[model samples]
Target: MKRITTLAGTLAFALTVGFTPVTLIQAQNKGRTEISVKELPKISSNSILGSFNADFSGHNVSSDFLINHLGEWLGTGSDHTYKLLKQNKDELGIKHSVYDHYYKGVKVMDDMILLHEKNGKLTYVNGEIITDINLSPNQQPTSQRIRSIIISDLKPQGKLTISNIEEVITKVSNGRKAVLYHASKVEALSMKPLKAFTYYIDNASGTVVKKNSRMHDADTPSTSTTYYKGDQSITVDSYNGEFRLKDNARNIHTMNGTNLDVDTINGGIINVEEYISPVANYTAVDTKPAVEVHWGMKNAYDYYMTRHNRNSYDGNGAKIDNYYNFDFGGFTGGANAAALDTPLYGGIVCMLYGNGTLFGGLLTLMNPVVGIDVAGHEYSHLIIGRNGLGGLNYESESGAINESIADMLGTAIEFYSGSSPNWTIGEGIPTASFLNPSPSPYMRSMSDPNNVNPGPQPDTYNGTYWASTANPDADNDHGGVHTNSGVGNYWFYLLSQGGSGTNDIGNPFNVTGITIEKAEKIIYRALTNYMTPNTTYMDAYNFTKQAVTDLYGASGNEQQQNVKAWYAVGIGNGILATSEAVRNQDHFNIYPNPVKEGVLTIENDKNNVSVEMYDASGRLIKGAQKLNKGTNKIYINNVQKGIYLLKVTSEGSGISTKKIIVE
Candidate 1:
């Protein structure tokens, strides 16, 4: 760490010396910033969930609280600090102070924390940061290098124009923990597959850092000018005697995407035009797709709320805004659909659906604006983004897992809200650009991932046709995010429907499908509770098994099936998660506090534990039972509706007595 007495002094020296493009005042001028990493609450050695419960209370606590409590962990004199990026207040009135990590006064790539607050107390947080950095102040991108990047990456005459560019500390994986300065730019490409690209260039070496496609898509499989659902009732808001395609009750609004930049193409633009019709029914031949988008989002919202107990994507009933028929480089639509948070704005999220891309004046790629499952898929991205499982860059194995999750959840929604003959993504939007396997006109297959046409869809981890993340870029679909997702997609399928097959690694296994209801619950629980931003396919295997242990007994049939499914998908035989291998043995979690449900889940890593339930009057309602090692489920159906105390004891791990309600 540099020996600087004040932040102002450091900035003045750096500026006067003409070294480093860091402006300390610029970060402070941003709204409510600087709650960054110093030290996160510690976890036990055998912990399953890398989470902590801190004792702190405040309504609008400043960063000083962190600096005071966490010592140097909150910067103080460290080389790294955090900048407030997004401020989100959900319907439940919980404030999610989203912060991005900055080191030496510049933003680091993919390092952020979502500090959650509710009822004047810090509740939860999830995010990660790279620690190893070696770039010096003088090594920052020079003005000449910036101009060179502009000329080489995007020429002034080129169609792709830069939206925003900045120097970022990119972590390089492999032998050691290190970082390199990269010029990151978000640019919109004009022709072919018209859309935006976020590419990075090594500032010193002048090599490409990597290009990631920021396509957080949620879409439907409807055909051109044809509604997939075929005439469904929709809600509309009326103002000035004109009916608009805005569902005030659900807070959903649809917009037309025409003559717009990459930012405007992806909704969240407050002043953008909303779809309006003079009549209550929006049946105009040209503007009918808006109807489908509105309806699809409604179902997506209702499904998450009703099925998962999540209020909306963020568990706070955030409004859903969507845009369809986005104009891309003179094309009516691009070739993708995405869930996006505007880079320039905080807490503003939107969905974008594009049509076929143009090929030499002919639109060749096709993406329909309506499909319930596709909409659910897109909504799943928003859900992932909010639930601490967000910030998974759409690249490498993390990106693959992220994509696969949406596929499974979206398919689950398809079963919940409508009918589906098959588990094919975008089955309604057949396109020549992306050729599906013969006789199947769709985007992807959860059931038979290997049967995809014209592309690699590996049902086993890193088996065949898997995209390598060695040097991820856009051409390889960001380390085969779409292609490698087949592995997880198959895992979910086998978990849903019983299957028997030999994996690519020559491992033969048979899995008993837990059914979609149970499987979806496990997926949701693992994702929201256990997953972090950079979770790998291998990590998913353990987390999901832990989710199973939480739902069922620690070693129930579901656990066995989970093992078999992963084996069948080439994720190895599975891990036992013994005390020796796992960490954070001190912490445990209990869920569904109201006890309205029949069962309550307890997650811990201690051994020789015991649980007891007592009534409000101190009378023992349930006798003490010897708890298992991993997870335990206690049934409350026998207990009467009243307030009760639940006590759990573990040798050397301490005892916990919590007040639980049974209804």
Candidate 2:
């Protein structure tokens, strides 16, 4: 006996057997006996079972009972081999041998023998055999099916279950861990096909992790289908997976592509799809999560946008991605630091917390003012990152310029954000007073440092002073960015509040008492448009003048006022002095004040002037306009704001120069 191994081989044999052909049978009876010859019956080609006949008392039965009995008997084999062979022969309609046998005592005495007749028939037998015989119609071999029944039964299921479907999809898509919440269950009858179900997926784990809503929907029953919900939530999940309907609790659906029975906890059943996979730390937050950070960033963004009409850090609307951390040191207190580290100079996207001391403490205490201004300041750094002023803290005048620019912007940002001008640094910090008590005064003074401490020294001089002798890092307080910044600081204060003719350092002209608005505009324009990375106090002088001129035409008194304001603070008339020639070309001349005849003083510095008095018309009279050195006193009755031209020679070059003026 051969052992049959696979179902495929058996099925093939059965199909072959079912198609075998058969011939019609006829019976003949003679005298007391009868004989019948019948061919094997053919089975239907499409039938799972093949046809067979029953042989009893020399009679062939073609009834369904015979076919069924034969099938049952053959099916008992270890592999149904006989049944498959018979089915193949029957299906093919091929002639095949049928085992012919009779009962032991039943034999044929003549061609037909009458033993026991029932109804109107006589039974007879041609021969009888006791042993089983082999019969084959046709045999052809094909690809063998080697799979065993037990082996197939042990195979694990490949389809995903409702609980695990979302996890699998998220893992495949993002390669991260996600979580799903089964908030509600849905009844089988309430389930709809191809509709999305809302699920709360927590992408980050832990107590601080935030969750977002993702929509999962499918067109057909599938392993997974992706659905996008705005720019915030997007998800793909298995089609027949569990879901929660609005009125029902969470429920699962069966694999037959139909909804499954689910147990409800409350009112109605609602299916929720969740992200159950884990993701990396740096994935960009969707629009919704970004809103959390937006609350903080919006103030800074709007300040620049509305006040400056700047879309973002670069002036072109760009998205900023922020992070909170403390990777670098050097921050004081527990204050948080905001950094613009991304490729997008769009704004300060990265902010670090210094355990709530300097950065964080200041932010916390000054939430009223420092919040928006500091954010604005940090973001401005991002702008500077692109349109940089050389290198930050560059030591030379450039360093001072950098600090001044930051101060200007920082103050401007505050004003823009609706804060009053305090002219103090870190006013938010309670311990950080603008002026120190005794020994050493404040770090910087916009008003008068000399007033607080005698030798404090104003920032008007073109000299550098070190705040600390121990630390040569120069960056101590960022190269005294806080220290030397006083010069520009005082300059701004003086310019804003008409100059006192002298800066903190007693200089000559006093033009104090200017409006803050004009000062702000001038400083802002200079910092943003005119100043460079290498700009010095002199450069700043030039830039401020240019800013004033550009904003208020050359002939405008506003420009002249700005020049006078700076001049009053010891800053010389910068490059624009040449341009102002035609606009305010008043010949340099001076008149004696409270003159007592013998002591007439002529005070002016434009050119070597020789006073040649013209009597009414054009005649020359008396003393040379070029008086001797020092203080020259000329005898004059009284002169008004009238016209005068004095012939003077260059003191060193000997070039005679001329200027027309009225006094």
Leading candidate by TM-score: 1
Clashes of each: 22, 96
Residue 113 of model 2, lDDT score: 10
Query: What's every prediction's RMSD, in angstroms?
Result: 12.0, 45.5
**Compared with the true structure, what per-residue lDDT tens digits does model 2 show for residues 1-663?**
111122222122221111111221111112221211222222211111111111121122322223223322222222111111111121112222222111121110001110111122211111111111121111211112111211232232221111111210010001111112111111011111111111112122211111111110001111211111112112222323432111111111111101211223332222322222232111333222222222224445665666556676666665543322221223333333344232111211333222223343443311122233344445565554434222232333444555555555555565654544455433332222223223222223456533323224345644334243122131354234445655676677666675554443455665544566677677766555434333456656756665564455443556656766666545774223321322111223232222223334444454554555443345543347566544566654554343333344445544322222323
- Model 1 whole-model lDDT (C-alpha atoms): 0.61
Give the least accurate 10-residue stretch of model 1, judged by summed lDDT: 12-21
lDDT of 2 at 432: 26
Candidate 1 at 576: error in angstroms? 3.5
Q: Compute the lDDT for candidate 2.
A: 0.33
Mind giving the per-residue lDDT tens digits that candidate 1 earns over 559-600?
677878898898756543221111122355555455665787
What shift in Å separates residue 247 of candidate 1 from its native position after superposition? 1.2
